[model samples]
Target: MNTTKLAGNFLLPISLLIFSLTAFSCSADLEDKVVGNWQGYDFLFQKTEGPDIVVTINGGLEQHLRSKLILSDNGTFQKLVGEYDNGKGTWVVEEDKLITTNENGEKLIYTLLKVTDKELMTLHEVDLKTPDGTLKGKIILSYTR
Candidate 1:
Protein backbone atom coordinates (compact mmCIF):
# COMPACT_ATOMS: atom_id res chain seq x y z
CA MET A 1 0.00 0.00 0.00
CA ASN A 2 1.03 3.58 -0.60
CA THR A 3 2.30 5.68 2.38
CA THR A 4 -0.82 7.87 2.52
CA LYS A 5 -3.18 4.88 2.45
CA LEU A 6 -1.18 3.04 5.13
CA ALA A 7 -1.19 6.08 7.41
CA GLY A 8 -4.92 6.58 6.99
CA ASN A 9 -5.59 2.91 7.72
CA PHE A 10 -3.69 3.09 11.04
CA LEU A 11 -4.96 6.54 12.14
CA LEU A 12 -8.39 5.42 13.29
CA PRO A 13 -7.06 2.58 15.44
CA ILE A 14 -4.43 4.83 17.00
CA SER A 15 -7.01 7.49 17.82
CA LEU A 16 -9.32 4.94 19.40
CA LEU A 17 -6.49 3.51 21.48
CA ILE A 18 -5.57 6.94 22.78
CA PHE A 19 -9.17 7.75 23.61
CA SER A 20 -9.61 4.49 25.48
CA LEU A 21 -6.43 5.08 27.46
CA THR A 22 -7.57 8.54 28.46
CA ALA A 23 -10.96 7.30 29.61
CA PHE A 24 -9.43 4.51 31.65
CA SER A 25 -7.00 6.90 33.32
CA CYS A 26 -9.75 9.29 34.31
CA SER A 27 -11.88 6.52 35.81
CA ALA A 28 -8.91 5.17 37.69
CA ASP A 29 -8.31 8.59 39.22
CA LEU A 30 -11.90 8.79 40.37
CA GLU A 31 -11.66 5.37 41.98
CA ASP A 32 -8.52 6.44 43.80
CA LYS A 33 -10.43 9.32 45.34
CA VAL A 34 -12.83 6.78 46.83
CA VAL A 35 -10.20 4.47 48.29
CA GLY A 36 -8.73 5.22 51.72
CA ASN A 37 -9.49 5.41 55.43
CA TRP A 38 -12.78 7.12 56.31
CA GLN A 39 -14.35 7.63 59.70
CA GLY A 40 -17.92 8.65 60.57
CA TYR A 41 -20.82 8.45 63.02
CA ASP A 42 -24.39 7.29 62.63
CA PHE A 43 -27.61 8.04 64.50
CA LEU A 44 -30.07 5.15 64.45
CA PHE A 45 -33.65 4.54 65.48
CA GLN A 46 -35.24 1.25 66.39
CA LYS A 47 -38.54 -0.06 67.59
CA THR A 48 -38.83 -1.81 70.90
CA GLU A 49 -41.41 -3.80 72.79
CA GLY A 50 -42.10 -3.41 76.47
CA PRO A 51 -44.05 -5.64 78.80
CA ASP A 52 -47.07 -3.42 78.37
CA ILE A 53 -46.91 -2.48 74.67
CA VAL A 54 -44.75 -2.22 71.54
CA VAL A 55 -43.48 1.22 70.81
CA THR A 56 -41.63 3.10 68.12
CA ILE A 57 -38.37 4.29 69.58
CA ASN A 58 -35.32 6.35 68.82
CA GLY A 59 -32.17 4.41 69.40
CA GLY A 60 -29.39 6.57 70.73
CA LEU A 61 -26.61 7.67 68.47
CA GLU A 62 -23.32 5.84 68.05
CA GLN A 63 -20.00 7.19 66.94
CA HIS A 64 -17.92 5.52 64.31
CA LEU A 65 -14.48 5.87 65.75
CA ARG A 66 -12.58 4.69 62.72
CA SER A 67 -13.15 3.12 59.30
CA LYS A 68 -10.94 1.96 56.50
CA LEU A 69 -12.26 1.70 52.92
CA ILE A 70 -10.33 -0.18 50.32
CA LEU A 71 -11.25 -0.32 46.64
CA SER A 72 -9.76 -2.63 44.09
CA ASP A 73 -8.26 -1.21 40.91
CA ASN A 74 -11.12 -2.47 38.78
CA GLY A 75 -13.71 -1.25 41.26
CA THR A 76 -15.24 -4.73 41.45
CA PHE A 77 -14.41 -5.47 45.08
CA GLN A 78 -14.44 -3.18 48.13
CA LYS A 79 -13.84 -3.87 51.80
CA LEU A 80 -14.59 -1.72 54.80
CA VAL A 81 -13.56 -1.98 58.42
CA GLY A 82 -15.59 0.24 60.75
CA GLU A 83 -15.11 0.72 64.45
CA TYR A 84 -17.99 1.98 66.53
CA ASP A 85 -18.88 2.44 70.18
CA ASN A 86 -20.09 -1.12 70.48
CA GLY A 87 -17.43 -2.84 68.44
CA LYS A 88 -16.02 -3.26 64.95
CA GLY A 89 -17.24 -5.17 61.90
CA THR A 90 -16.46 -5.79 58.26
CA TRP A 91 -18.48 -4.17 55.51
CA VAL A 92 -18.80 -4.31 51.77
CA VAL A 93 -19.56 -1.77 49.09
CA GLU A 94 -22.01 -2.73 46.39
CA GLU A 95 -23.58 -0.51 43.76
CA ASP A 96 -21.90 2.42 45.51
CA LYS A 97 -23.63 1.52 48.76
CA LEU A 98 -22.02 0.27 52.00
CA ILE A 99 -23.57 -2.58 53.91
CA THR A 100 -22.59 -4.50 57.02
CA THR A 101 -24.16 -7.54 58.58
CA ASN A 102 -23.81 -8.06 62.30
CA GLU A 103 -23.43 -11.34 64.11
CA ASN A 104 -27.13 -11.31 64.83
CA GLY A 105 -27.86 -11.15 61.07
CA GLU A 106 -28.93 -7.54 61.16
CA LYS A 107 -28.10 -5.85 57.89
CA LEU A 108 -27.29 -2.16 57.80
CA ILE A 109 -27.09 -0.20 54.61
CA TYR A 110 -25.35 3.12 54.06
CA THR A 111 -25.04 5.23 50.99
CA LEU A 112 -21.98 7.39 50.59
CA LEU A 113 -23.06 10.92 49.93
CA LYS A 114 -19.76 12.68 49.80
CA VAL A 115 -16.10 12.03 50.49
CA THR A 116 -13.21 14.44 50.70
CA ASP A 117 -9.71 14.56 51.98
CA LYS A 118 -10.96 15.85 55.34
CA GLU A 119 -14.57 14.78 55.50
CA LEU A 120 -17.14 12.10 54.65
CA MET A 121 -20.90 11.97 54.72
CA THR A 122 -23.40 9.12 54.47
CA LEU A 123 -27.10 8.40 54.75
CA HIS A 124 -28.48 5.37 56.57
CA GLU A 125 -31.93 3.93 56.63
CA VAL A 126 -33.37 0.90 58.35
CA ASP A 127 -36.76 -0.72 58.33
CA LEU A 128 -38.08 -3.48 60.52
CA LYS A 129 -41.36 -5.20 61.09
CA THR A 130 -42.74 -6.85 64.16
CA PRO A 131 -46.05 -8.48 65.06
CA ASP A 132 -47.43 -5.03 65.82
CA GLY A 133 -46.30 -3.13 62.69
CA THR A 134 -43.43 -1.81 60.65
CA LEU A 135 -40.97 0.90 61.68
CA LYS A 136 -38.43 2.89 59.75
CA GLY A 137 -35.98 5.75 60.17
CA LYS A 138 -33.47 7.76 58.22
CA ILE A 139 -30.22 8.97 59.69
CA ILE A 140 -27.37 11.10 58.42
CA LEU A 141 -23.78 10.41 59.33
CA SER A 142 -20.86 12.80 59.11
CA TYR A 143 -17.17 12.32 59.69
CA THR A 144 -13.83 14.04 59.43
CA ARG A 145 -11.06 12.42 57.50
Candidate 2:
Protein backbone atom coordinates (compact mmCIF):
# COMPACT_ATOMS: atom_id res chain seq x y z
CA MET A 1 0.00 0.00 0.00
CA ASN A 2 1.25 3.50 -0.76
CA THR A 3 2.29 5.28 2.50
CA THR A 4 0.58 8.52 1.50
CA LYS A 5 -2.68 6.76 0.75
CA LEU A 6 -2.59 4.99 4.15
CA ALA A 7 -1.96 8.25 5.98
CA GLY A 8 -4.74 10.00 4.08
CA ASN A 9 -7.27 7.30 5.01
CA PHE A 10 -6.40 7.58 8.76
CA LEU A 11 -6.49 11.38 8.66
CA LEU A 12 -10.05 11.49 7.32
CA PRO A 13 -11.49 9.48 10.21
CA ILE A 14 -9.51 11.48 12.78
CA SER A 15 -10.73 14.75 11.32
CA LEU A 16 -14.36 13.54 11.29
CA LEU A 17 -14.14 12.40 14.89
CA ILE A 18 -12.76 15.73 15.99
CA PHE A 19 -15.49 17.58 14.13
CA SER A 20 -18.22 15.46 15.69
CA LEU A 21 -16.88 16.06 19.19
CA THR A 22 -16.66 19.78 18.57
CA ALA A 23 -20.22 19.93 17.29
CA PHE A 24 -21.50 18.02 20.29
CA SER A 25 -19.71 20.33 22.70
CA CYS A 26 -21.12 23.36 20.93
CA SER A 27 -24.62 21.93 21.11
CA ALA A 28 -24.27 21.47 24.85
CA ASP A 29 -23.16 25.04 25.16
CA LEU A 30 -26.20 26.15 23.21
CA GLU A 31 -28.43 24.20 25.54
CA ASP A 32 -26.81 25.99 28.44
CA LYS A 33 -28.08 29.29 27.05
CA VAL A 34 -31.61 28.02 27.73
CA VAL A 35 -31.01 27.28 31.37
CA GLY A 36 -32.64 29.98 33.46
CA ASN A 37 -35.96 31.63 34.29
CA TRP A 38 -37.99 32.52 31.24
CA GLN A 39 -41.17 34.53 31.23
CA GLY A 40 -43.75 34.55 28.49
CA TYR A 41 -43.22 37.47 26.17
CA ASP A 42 -45.52 36.59 23.32
CA PHE A 43 -48.07 33.87 22.74
CA LEU A 44 -49.93 33.91 19.45
CA PHE A 45 -52.27 31.16 18.37
CA GLN A 46 -53.45 32.18 14.95
CA LYS A 47 -55.84 30.32 12.78
CA THR A 48 -55.92 30.48 9.03
CA GLU A 49 -57.66 33.61 7.73
CA GLY A 50 -58.72 34.60 11.18
CA PRO A 51 -57.66 36.80 14.04
CA ASP A 52 -55.03 35.68 16.53
CA ILE A 53 -55.88 34.35 19.91
CA VAL A 54 -55.52 37.04 22.51
CA VAL A 55 -53.13 36.89 25.44
CA THR A 56 -53.62 39.94 27.53
CA ILE A 57 -50.54 41.30 29.25
CA ASN A 58 -52.23 43.99 31.30
CA GLY A 59 -52.66 42.07 34.55
CA GLY A 60 -55.90 40.55 33.42
CA LEU A 61 -57.02 36.97 33.83
CA GLU A 62 -55.14 35.91 30.75
CA GLN A 63 -52.07 37.70 31.98
CA HIS A 64 -52.36 35.92 35.27
CA LEU A 65 -52.64 32.66 33.36
CA ARG A 66 -49.39 33.21 31.55
CA SER A 67 -46.79 30.60 32.38
CA LYS A 68 -43.22 30.98 33.46
CA LEU A 69 -40.85 28.23 32.44
CA ILE A 70 -37.78 27.31 34.36
CA LEU A 71 -35.19 25.18 32.63
CA SER A 72 -32.40 23.45 34.48
CA ASP A 73 -29.09 22.18 33.19
CA ASN A 74 -30.03 18.76 34.54
CA GLY A 75 -32.72 18.39 31.85
CA THR A 76 -35.59 19.00 34.24
CA PHE A 77 -38.20 21.75 33.91
CA GLN A 78 -41.07 23.35 35.70
CA LYS A 79 -43.84 25.28 34.01
CA LEU A 80 -46.26 27.27 36.07
CA VAL A 81 -49.20 28.23 33.94
CA GLY A 82 -51.39 29.33 36.75
CA GLU A 83 -52.05 28.59 40.36
CA TYR A 84 -53.79 25.36 39.43
CA ASP A 85 -51.68 24.28 36.47
CA ASN A 86 -48.13 23.59 37.52
CA GLY A 87 -46.27 20.92 35.57
CA LYS A 88 -42.94 19.17 35.84
CA GLY A 89 -41.13 17.59 32.95
CA THR A 90 -37.86 16.45 31.43
CA TRP A 91 -36.57 18.15 28.32
CA VAL A 92 -34.04 17.40 25.61
CA VAL A 93 -32.88 19.11 22.50
CA GLU A 94 -32.72 17.05 19.32
CA GLU A 95 -31.30 19.09 16.51
CA ASP A 96 -33.34 22.32 16.69
CA LYS A 97 -36.36 20.86 18.43
CA LEU A 98 -37.16 20.91 22.10
CA ILE A 99 -38.93 17.79 23.32
CA THR A 100 -40.52 17.95 26.72
CA THR A 101 -41.91 14.79 28.26
CA ASN A 102 -44.12 15.29 31.26
CA GLU A 103 -44.43 12.99 34.27
CA ASN A 104 -47.49 11.40 32.66
CA GLY A 105 -45.53 10.33 29.59
CA GLU A 106 -47.05 12.98 27.34
CA LYS A 107 -44.54 14.57 25.03
CA LEU A 108 -44.73 18.02 23.46
CA ILE A 109 -42.37 18.88 20.65
CA TYR A 110 -41.46 22.43 19.76
CA THR A 111 -39.33 23.47 16.85
CA LEU A 112 -36.82 26.03 18.04
CA LEU A 113 -37.19 28.91 15.64
CA LYS A 114 -34.85 31.24 17.48
CA VAL A 115 -32.63 31.30 20.55
CA THR A 116 -30.51 34.09 21.98
CA ASP A 117 -29.01 35.00 25.31
CA LYS A 118 -32.27 36.64 26.34
CA GLU A 119 -34.93 35.29 24.00
CA LEU A 120 -36.18 31.97 22.72
CA MET A 121 -38.94 31.48 20.22
CA THR A 122 -40.47 28.12 19.42
CA LEU A 123 -43.12 26.96 16.98
CA HIS A 124 -45.58 24.26 17.86
CA GLU A 125 -48.38 22.71 15.86
CA VAL A 126 -51.41 21.06 17.29
CA ASP A 127 -55.00 20.16 16.51
CA LEU A 128 -57.33 22.77 17.85
CA LYS A 129 -61.07 23.06 18.06
CA THR A 130 -62.42 25.87 15.95
CA PRO A 131 -65.89 27.19 15.40
CA ASP A 132 -66.01 25.52 12.03
CA GLY A 133 -64.22 22.29 12.86
CA THR A 134 -61.02 20.83 14.17
CA LEU A 135 -57.87 21.81 12.36
CA LYS A 136 -54.17 22.05 12.86
CA GLY A 137 -52.69 25.45 13.58
CA LYS A 138 -49.42 26.92 14.66
CA ILE A 139 -48.58 28.24 18.08
CA ILE A 140 -45.70 30.66 18.25
CA LEU A 141 -44.33 31.19 21.73
CA SER A 142 -41.70 33.71 22.62
CA TYR A 143 -39.93 33.76 25.93
CA THR A 144 -37.42 36.07 27.58
CA ARG A 145 -35.51 36.12 30.82
Query: Against the true structure, whose TM-score is highest?
Result: 2
Q: Residue 118 of candidate 1: its Cα lDDT? A: 66
- Tell me each candidate's TM-score: 0.42, 0.66
Q: Per-candidate RMSD vs. true structure?
A: 18.8, 15.5
Give one clash count per candidate, in the order shown.
Answer: 0, 0
Report the C-alpha displacement of residue 83, candidate 2, in angstroms.
4.0
> For candidate 2, lDDT tens digit of each residue in 1-145?
3432343355445434533543443446658777888888775443433323332212223552377888898999898875445788899887766888999989999866666789877667667555655645555677888
Off by over 4 Å in 1: 1-85, 128-135
User: What is the RMSD of candidate 1?
Assistant: 18.8
Worst 10 residues of 2 by lDDT: 51-60
Per-residue CA lDDT of model 1 for 62-129, tens digit only, reads 22334343433343322343432343344565553556565556677766555456655556664656
